[model samples]
Target: MLKFRELLVQSLLNDKDEGEEIEDEQDVPIPRKNAKSTHIMKKFEGNARQNRKRCISCYDKLQKEKGTKEARAKTKRVMTYCDECDNKPAMCLECFNEKHPSKYF
Candidate 1:
């Protein structure tokens, strides 16, 4: 079996060759000057399965970085401040929820 480092190198080389092939093919249909090269972002265009796998891999990496076996928090928090209560930059989700209820708004 190929070692991990060799596998990574092979993948990188394959990616470079694929990109070169694409560039060569593009030149055949249109002149380089009139190509109007545009880079379309494809991060959100994958199917559900690809997206789920990517998410799982990212979550695993994050958990390893955090060095915690406990399930990560699902809630998303922003570096925001509560104007009503003294402006604190690191306002957590729980605190924000407790401070502002549905009826308050």
Candidate 2:
């Protein structure tokens, strides 16, 4: 074991003398692509009133057409939710696609 340790130390000394630098695996920086903004659409189950969430885009359109009060009262409710979107907005399939064009179903 002592002989093996001496040989290993000698080899490391030789490598240093030869100007070969040993790189630690953890010290290396990994190359990564720019992070993409993505969203995952999930569906709510059961027929409760709490499950009936309004589609954000539709609600926005309604707000523009009518007003906030009227839009809140009249906007159609959907069962889908986008996890990564702001406020985790509820959206229908079409609205989800329109909002996140880069994401595929």
In terms of TM-score, the best-performing candidate is 2
Error of 1 at 69 (Å): 20
lDDT of 2 by residue, 29-96 (tens): 54423233346798888875779898889999999999999999988788898887778889988888
Q: Which ten residues in a row have the lowest lDDT in candidate 1?
A: 34-43
Residue runs of model 1 more than 4 Å from their true location after superposition: 1-78, 87-89
Clashing pairs in 2: none
lDDT of each: 0.39, 0.75
User: Estimated TM-score per prediction?
Assistant: 0.21, 0.55
Model 2 vs. true fold: TM: 0.55
Q: What's the distance in Å from true for residue 38, model 1? A: 45
